[model samples]
Target chain A: MIRLNRLCAGYFGKTVIQEVTMEFLPGKVTVLLGPNGSGKSTLLKASLGLLPLTGGEVLYDDVDIRRLKRRQIAQKAAFLTQSRNTPSIQALRMVLHGRFPYLTYPRHYGGQDYAIARGAMDATGSRQHENTNVSLLSGGQRQGVYLAMALAQDTRTLFMDEPTTYLDIGRQFHMMRTARSLAREGKAVVLVLHDICLALREADRVAVLQEGRLLCLGEPDAIYQSGALEQVFGVGVHRVDTPHGMQYYCVPQQVPGRIAEECQNT
Target chain B: MSSLRIFSTRRSDIIFWAGLCALTLGAAALGLWTGSVKLEPAQVLDALTGRDGTSAAARIVLYSRLPRTCAAMLAGAALAVSGAVIQTVLDNPLASPSVIGVNSGAGFAVALVCAAAPLAQRYTPLVAFGGALAGVLLVAGLSQRTGASRMTVILAGVAISAMFSAGIDTAVTLVPDAISGVTDFRIGGFTGVTMAQLAPAAGLIFVSLGIVFSLSQQMDILALGSDTAQSLGLSVGPVRITLLVLAAALAGAAVSFCGLMGFVGLIVPHTMRRLLGKGSLSLMVSSALGGAFFVTMCDLAARVLFSPFELPVGIILAFAGAPFFLWLLFKQRGGRT
Candidate 1:
């Protein structure tokens, strides 16, 4: 489990994420949803110790994460940003690098490392393209390769920032399904998702943030009922029941004066 | 099953070793045969084994050709490996010792040593090494503060290079008579190399090569983006700094000996990347051998083409390497984002 206690962080001198307390439970997928520039990425970075915490502390299994070495932190959690590009030929060897922390100086990967990397490739369904250059792969294939690299780390926690962005509809759903399955395998998977519907469908729990503050954190049912996302997004939302599950959709509730002004301008 | 696979993979690596040996032997032969007072293959071999031969050919082989050959091989390997390391560390194909100003820094130091300290005039390599280190430190400090952006680092290197060249100009203007042989050194040659110069430089180059070879895997990891490297449990910052220092040291030692032989570092690694796949281990070894061959050939051309009036090897390399560099730049430009 990863816990954040009154954490604050920023770049240079400006603070992007305020004091925020949260916990990520294992065997669960926690989706963080927020509007643009709402500090969602910052919070994730702070949790991973990528950015310095200005006010509070983050703990992994009750141990202060900031005090741990970077390699140790890497062994505990794997972080994947939206897009990562590397040399085309170095792609597979790059994935094998996930075994670095376990090796000593003059490090060389042994059989166990290759086994883990191959296992990760198989798990992510990237085995066919193991020898392919990453740059030559399509967006979805590259995303899978990156996911395989993260999985190769064998960490308990996985942090992804919009892993499905820039992908087609099919790829988006495929990636979300992969994340859900990974969470089911007992890893704590945290994701920052822009697509609210996708988050509502895949997330075991949802956290809503606005203006660097956590407005709501609960299961989908409770968060949907709270009207927190509606207020945060400044729109009207309807929670409807489908045969499969609960679905939430947003609608624009017209304000008389603003609507008239926008119409006149158009 | 995996062990068998790895063993087979190891077996194929023999091809790379064989190729390197072939190139090394060819370059050594060329270096021996293409000097003034050239000896036949048998006489060169006889001289090499310290067997009886024509005294003039033996003396030429021992005193002149051998040291030049060793110097060329050592400098070429050092520069090539250093370039590869820098390119990987900076994640820029253009990040060569010459392009990024390490050689210019060493050159300026030699120029200054030639002008100021009489003792430094005799021990020019030490001064050049010191200057190279200082130059690397300056670039590192500037780039670190600015977040080491690709354009920023390159621009900073160019700016520092210009400043150092200006310093060289000033020193030359002040003490013209002090550096009567400065022109030939600046152009770079292997005509007058002695064994004494080759010995210490060879030792330093090997040490640097050993350090880089040991860290080859980590370097391969680092060639990925910084975030990926960090995620993979490699300490990106320290690893980059360490590799940069190692690259500077190797480049420095090479410049101290060869007077800024350009293009070997920039060209060799890229050629290896194209020929062999980008496995760091194979690329590193291939680059070392390729560099040695290229420099030896260039030096040989310099010796034979002009015959009695020897042209500096640097001129030949610049003439050849500059056009290739321009072609690469245009290709990269056409493919730009």
Candidate 2:
């Protein structure tokens, strides 16, 4: 539903993401993979109209997004930014803000809105904590609340920036599973993750960025085989076959070329 | 399950509003009745009802008790609400109108007005509002340009406040004889506030209060941080500026009439946030009620605590507020409030 054409975006007259092109289709978990300062967040913000575009335009369907107001863009995309403040408010209230894009001036919410928010909480398995103060929640529980908020937004596209950061291993599995299920439900799921193996294993399509440039975009397996992870992140990846299916694991390689081949052979 | 939670929360909100109303009424009545004249509650009521028309009791009630009480309550609510909004906008608990130089900005402007046109008492609030808005905009603009952290905003505000204080001093020294009422402007009291002086400031306070209430939900979203608020489709820049402008207006109007009553904004809203939550609507409402009661009681105490020798209301507020500020600093060591 969204397309980026030669997009160049940055802050304060300095371009960090330059000449990038990609498409986010329905029923796909498109994970953006990159090292530090690779413009992953900037590219995401530019796509969501959160940053000023210096060059090419972003299109929502066929129309340029500049024609849209923040509210209008919000109707099409529910964006979860990287950093969030912990205000001492109810978790349910946090989720209810997902209905904000649908609200008009005076921004009133009603029974239906509350019902929808509750339903979202249920979907994210966070209903139990609805009455709890969000600030007091554990890191994993807080991420769950934020995920519930995105679910409550009820948009066709959801963008999560580093959703897995503070999650423990078990919670990471749960988050990845949720993202996969969300894509299966035909929503465009675009996320940025630092974990190479997690991104490669879970993503339907992987987009690797290097120094603000798109290195590769294809099926996860193809991108992995292209050595883009090693090239961009200096990481060694090896594929292993298990009872269920093929899985990939990556480890940082101080000396790039031989370590990956060694990992594959072993 | 969520509905049950909602119901309980709503009930609590109702309880809070009702309880605050009772307390505010009691405080206001005491303010009206307890004075140097030693009038009874019956005499106060009779004066209020106009049954003692033009009598000594009636004149005291009409001229002294009524204006001062209204001034004290309105000033409290305005300053408290302003501080709350400022704190939210800057995303710093320590950011208040008084702390962030909003009052000092108004004080500086009032001093300039006194120096330039001592006959411009009618325009003091307006002048103060302009000064306050300019000061807040400068501070906010600086913070934004520098990409400030929460603590940085408060620091910037303190620096700006200090600069304004210097300007105020210079203004006072430039024509010390012209602005003889500088202490009255600085100390802030309701004692001689004619209804004429209170009316304009009251109008500005009410209008500003209305706007803040209407935008409470938006303000809550704003407290969520700039990126999240913008992602949620809030016009963060405009909404933040609007909130800051209103905060300045509220503080400016109050300071124009009552002098810089420090920490009413900081103390009342911070306390209300603890009693309630950070829900902007409830926090603002509770702050208003709590502030009205707090300032009224302080005013009453200033007049009666050492009867026959009234102290300026600001003195009492400073005594209470400065320690509360220190306590907040102590509590915030863990970096969450």
Candidate 3:
């Protein structure tokens, strides 16, 4: 389990995330839900040591994450950063980089590393574009390649920031399913997502943040019962039960009233 | 249970390497056979075997053509590999040794060494290596201080290059006599290099190439961006600095031998990426070979094109490289938005 204790982090001196505490357990999916600029990405980055800790420490099973060597931490935790640049590299080669923690200097990737990478590619259904340059891949294919890279890391803990952004609904479902499988395989999967229905349907637990503060953290149903998502996102939350599972739908709150007020003022 | 398959390369990779090898050999042969005295294949063979005595043809072949050809090949490979490393590390296609002021830094150091002590000229390669590191460090340090964004780094590099070029101008004005022997060097040509002089630069290039190859995987990971690379266990800052140092060493060693040759680094690596794809290892190897072929071919052209008049190889490269670089900049901008 990875735990954040009073974590404070940001760029330069301005703290984007402050005094936040959270715990991620193995064999479950913990989804971080927040509106824009709500410090979800910052909190995740701080926990992984990608951002400097201004106050508290991230403890991995009672040991400070910062105290451990990078490779040691990497051996346990893998991260999939927000989709950004797709390097002009072959997809399989990009996946193989996840084996870096296990690789020692002077020994390049061996057959075992290849096996792991290929397994990851197979798991993510990215084997079709294994030899293709990632830059040429479609949005869905590109996300799959990056997820395959994180999967190839083969860590006990995985963190993904906005993995489904820019992806089609089909790809988003595919990604969430893959994340579910990783959790099922006994990995701690933490993700930041904006789609509340996907979060409600897929997340074992959900943490909501608003203006750099944790509004609530609990099981998805409990958070839904608490009616916190409506307050955090300024939207009305409606829940329904489908044959598959619970489903959530949201609509912007008081839109007609706000427009009427603006018209009166003008 | 099913079989496990890991990393695999397409058949094109095999064909690419083979083609590059054959092309290099052909270029090398043509390099050897097409000098002023224009030796026949038999004469070239006899010269290689030391069957001929110290005839004028043998002297030209053994002393002049041999070292110049080797220098061109080595310089080309060094610059191209340096460019490839810089492009990957910076994650910007526009970044090259010359664009980032590495060449200007080495050139400034060479100028200073020459002006400081004419007899100490043999240490120019070492001093130039130090200078290249300092120059790149200056740019990197400044960019890091300002923000370390790709745009900031590129702007810092341009500023640093302008500053170093000014320094070079000052050094030349201060010591006119010091530049007499470096005239061909300043123009970036392999005119009068001897075997002994070419040896040290060759040593640096070969060793630095080894280091670059060993670190190629890390560099590939780095191209994924700093956050992802660091999260993957790479100490991004140190690995980046080390790679930059190695790149500086490469650009410096090349600049020490052949003055501030541009476009070989920019053009060769970019070409290799298009032809061989973006595997750093393949790009490194193929870029080195492609660069060697490119510069050697350019040198051959410079020698033969205007014949006795002879043009500097840099002139040939600039004509080819500048337009492509501009096109790349536009293409990158188009891709982004």
Candidate 4:
């Protein structure tokens, strides 16, 4: 389990995320949903110690993460950044980097490490291209490789920032399903996603942030039912029931008296 | 920590290393044989084995050509390995000792030290090493202050190189007597390099190479970008600083003895990467061998091409490297890293 208490962090002396408290429990897929520059990514980075917190502490299993060494933190959790600067190396070798903390002096990776990397790739559906260079992979395939690396870390928690961006619709669903499966396996899977419908359908819980503030945090159904999603997004959200289960969609809001004024002018 | 293997022992990797070993041996032989007074390969071998140490051929081979050949090979290997580390740390394929002004920085320091104390020639290599470190720090510091982006590093390198070159020019002007000392260094060469001079530089190169070898795997991780490296449990700042310092030491050691031999660092690593993939260990090994072969062969040409009169090996390298670099740029534009 990981908890962020009153976390405050940002770049160049300006706070991007302020006074945010959140907990990521094991066996749950917690998706952070927000618009651009809404501090979702900032919060995740701050919790990981990637960005220095000005006013908070991140506790990993009741211990302050700031007191832990980088390698120790990495052992407890793995992170996948949104930007994928794909290295020009074979997919298997790139995935092998996840075992880096386990590797020591002389910097050699053993058969067991390779096997673990292979397993991670297989788990992420990137096994087919293991022998190929990652630069040759498509965006979706590359994202799979990155996920494989995070999975290969073999940590208790995994954090991904926009893992599905630039991927096709099918790949997006595949990624979400992978995260769901990973959560089901008892790892805490945390993500910042832009797709609200996917978040509602795929995530076990959703935390919505607007303008660097957490507006709502609950199960997707409850959050949608409470009308917090619509209020946060400034759009009307419609929920419908179908054979596929509850479905949510967004519609542009209408002005209160502008319609009547336009009718009178016409 | 668990036992790990960062590089797989592939058949292709074996073949590549073997090929490089053969090329290095051939280049060393040619370098030993094709000087101003040519010696047959058999005679060169016999002289090397001390079959007749008193003979004129043996004397020339042992006393004159052997040290020069060793110096060329060592200098090549050092520069090439340094370039590989620099490129990885900076995440820029265009980064190299010469491009980033490390060579000029060392050269400037060597000239300044020689100018200030002409009799303190024994300290030249150490001063050069210090200058190289300073140069890299200046570039890194400037980049950090600005944006530390790829373009910022390159631009800062250019600016630093110009400043160092100006320093060298000033030193030369202020002390005309230092011109004689700085001449060979300015136009990098193997002339007049004795076993004594080669020994210190060799020690520095060897130590720095060991450091580089130990961290080669991490270098691959660093090349993936800082964010990725951090997530993988690497303390990116310390690792990057160590690599930069090692690279500067390697290049500085080479420049102290070989006089700013350019392109070997850039060309060798790039060539090795093309042949061996991005595994840092294999790339580094191949680059070392390839660089040695290239410099030894170029030095041989510099000696035998015009015979009685010698051209500086740096000129040969520049003439060859410029066209190849252009071709590389075009190829990169056509493809993608």
Which structure among the candidates has the greatest DockQ? 2
Q: Candidate 4: how close is chain B to the reference, as a TM-score?
A: 0.92
Identify the leading candidate in terms of TM-score. Answer: 2
Model 2 spans > 4 angstroms off:
A256-266, B1-10, B177-181
Candidate 4 chain B, which ten residues in sequence have the lowest lDDT sum? B1-10
The digit string of per-residue lDDT tens for model 3 on B106-212 reads 99999988888889989878988988898888877776667677777888889888888889888988898876645566658888888899899889999999989
lDDT of 1 by residue, B211-292 (tens): 8888888887776677777767777788888888888878878887788677888998988886666567777878888888
Residue A213 displacement in candidate 2 (angstroms): 0.4
lDDT per residue (tens digit) for residues B165-218 in model 2: 899889889889755456766766776788998999999999999999989989
Error of 1 at A125 (Å): 1.3
Q: Candidate 4: where is the Cα deviation over 4 Å?
A: A104-107, A254-266, B1-10, B179-183, B330-337
Could you report the DockQ of all the candidates, in the order they appear? 0.56, 0.66, 0.61, 0.53
**DockQ of the two-chain complex in candidate 4:** 0.53
Comparing 2 with 4 on TM-score, the higher-scoring candidate is 2
Q: Which stretches of candidate 3 lie over 4 Å from their true place?
A: A241-245, A255-264, B1-10, B181-183
Give the per-residue Cα lDDT of candidate 3 at B58.
78
For candidate 1, lDDT tens digit of each residue in A103-215?
87647788999989888888878877766666567778777778888998899999999998888998888888888899889999999999877787789999999988888
How high a TM-score does candidate 1 get? 0.92
lDDT of 2 by residue, A1-266 (tens): 99999999999999999899999989999999999999999999999998999999899987899999888888888887787788877888888998998997667888899999999999889989988888789877887888888788888899999988877898888888999999999999999999888887889999999989999999988997798888787768988998867888877677756879889999
Model 4 global lDDT (CA atoms, 0 to 1): 0.85
Better of 3 and 4 by lDDT: 3
Pairs with steric clashes in candidate 2: B188-B258
